[model samples]
Target: MSDSNKTDFTNPSTFILVGIPGLEVAHVWISIPFCTMYTIVVLGNFIILFIVKTEPSLHMPMYYFLCMLAVTDLVLSTSTLPKMLSIYWFNSREINFSACLTQMHFIHCFSVMESGIFVAMAFDRYVAICHPLRHSTILTNHVVAKIGLALVLRGMMVILPFPFLASQWPYCRTNIIPHLYCEHMAVVNLACGDTRVSSYYGLFVVFCVRGLDVIFIAMSYTQILRAIFSLPTKDARLKALETCSSHLWAILSFYIPGLFSSLTHRFGHNVPLYFHVLIVSVYLLVPPMLNPIIYGVRTKQIQDRLLWLFTHKGI
Candidate 1:
């Protein structure tokens, strides 16, 4: 009867990571862009943090949410990219089970927190455009602090169970995870025992957090449009609508890739695992790379400060 319960993950000492399957010959080429993007992500986010902290004019509710976004982006990218690079550049794909779980935990935690920040940004725009006078009272320093704390708390609570649940299962199948990063689904699929409960919960969380965030962000923009159209002059309408462009760009950059990858994974039966991994990687990489660029190009204050900082050699 003991033979009936054999599992490769009885203790699960180590796991082999398969970075970009079927493209082993091109790993070097792949690493180049991934490395470049990660560098850009780190540099851009830190610059945003610096600009937001130094510029007093950018210290309002909108920029405060942007700061939170930057922080989440930094942590999330740092959590995944180094390990990915190790696998790609050095071929050091072996990772301890505990370390793998820890990495997955942070990835999910920071992802959820990033979504919360986007939600907060949507609310900031809603108040600023819809109720300019009440924006101050509604989104004070204390309130922003509380919201930030709640975001972190919610992320910790919701994602903490993921790795734990994944770890509980005995993985008799191949210990090779076919992805650049240790994602929840990819890791969980290697388990030998029942995974339906954990997998369903993961899906439910994705729907609850990501689906709802997208819906709310869209709703917020709808109201913002109504408010802009109600303005007395075309110039006033244009000005109000322009303020939303940066946030809209951010939302699209984040959610579109995620949703596209998710839908294709579910429906694209012909799609190979390598393509799926590629989609997931792109899903994670795009936001960090594009968010700062969006802010720099779309937000006048950020653009002006960026140019001034470069020219003046000081903030």
Candidate 2:
């Protein structure tokens, strides 16, 4: 057999992304809400990035991490949503094998990248609260830039195998992906061959990136609380804690829905397909929409800047 035939014989030329298996009739109606949410997602994250990049005073460790988070959200949502909307609006469900792999790559890479940014933000809060006198020295521009690059590289290294693993397997079974987006495991699960390796790798990457990040984020916040309580006065303690509130909200908004969706998909045997699909949809849209809101509402700098931009037409 020739190389091209061997490639074709190994993997299907394309895969069909079935959006909400049981709710085919409602896909058109469903697109309305999702379209609205995606609009908010795009506009909101871009606004956050715009403020961060344009504001000279905001060029610090905290906002720099926020900017990275925004970039991830922007890329992650863009990677998944266009295909999703096409399926809904145009009823275009066919995705080429390579395109599916590309989508899977961006989805996993950006999600892991966002997880690292959260960890970075947690460290920023820890330093600002626990060691304010040395915060600047600890989180210099050079240090933050390096951290950002390292996070992206870590994500790239860990997720690089996702597509390769899938391609190695013989997808001799059905090519219908159950979920809306081309998630790594979703593509892997369609393989006719043994799926243990792909599944285990997916879990391994999640544990290594998100799991450890959560652990360290918890530790950082614990220390922040200890330092806050050690403050000399009530006002001082409250002042210190106030700075951490936005970040905690951001963490909850990003992780809670994400973990819930992943768990429900994996273990919720009795979950209806519509609900499972809805959870996945929420996981993708919620963080992009809420991160900007969380920061805008809780951070004085972002809030004031937003107000000034609106009131003064950005001067």
**lDDT, candidate 1, residue 212?**
89
Candidate 1 lDDT, tens digit per residue, 154-212? 99999988998988888887778888888888888888778988778887777887888
lDDT for predicted candidate 1 compared with the true structure: 0.86
Best by lDDT: 1
* Pairs in steric clash, model 1: none
- Give RMSD to native, each candidate: 2.9, 3.4
Per-residue lDDT of 84 in model 1: 86
Clash count for each candidate, listed in order shown: 0, 0
lDDT of 2 by residue, 1-315 (tens): 134323435678878888988998998999998888889888888899999887888989999999898889888888988888999889898899999998988898888899999999999999998888999999999999999999989989889999888888987657778879888777887777688988887778766678999999999999999999998999998988899898898899888888887777667889998788878877888888888888888889998888889899944
Residue 14 of model 1, lDDT score: 78
**Which residue segments of model 2 deviate by more than 4 Å?**
1-9
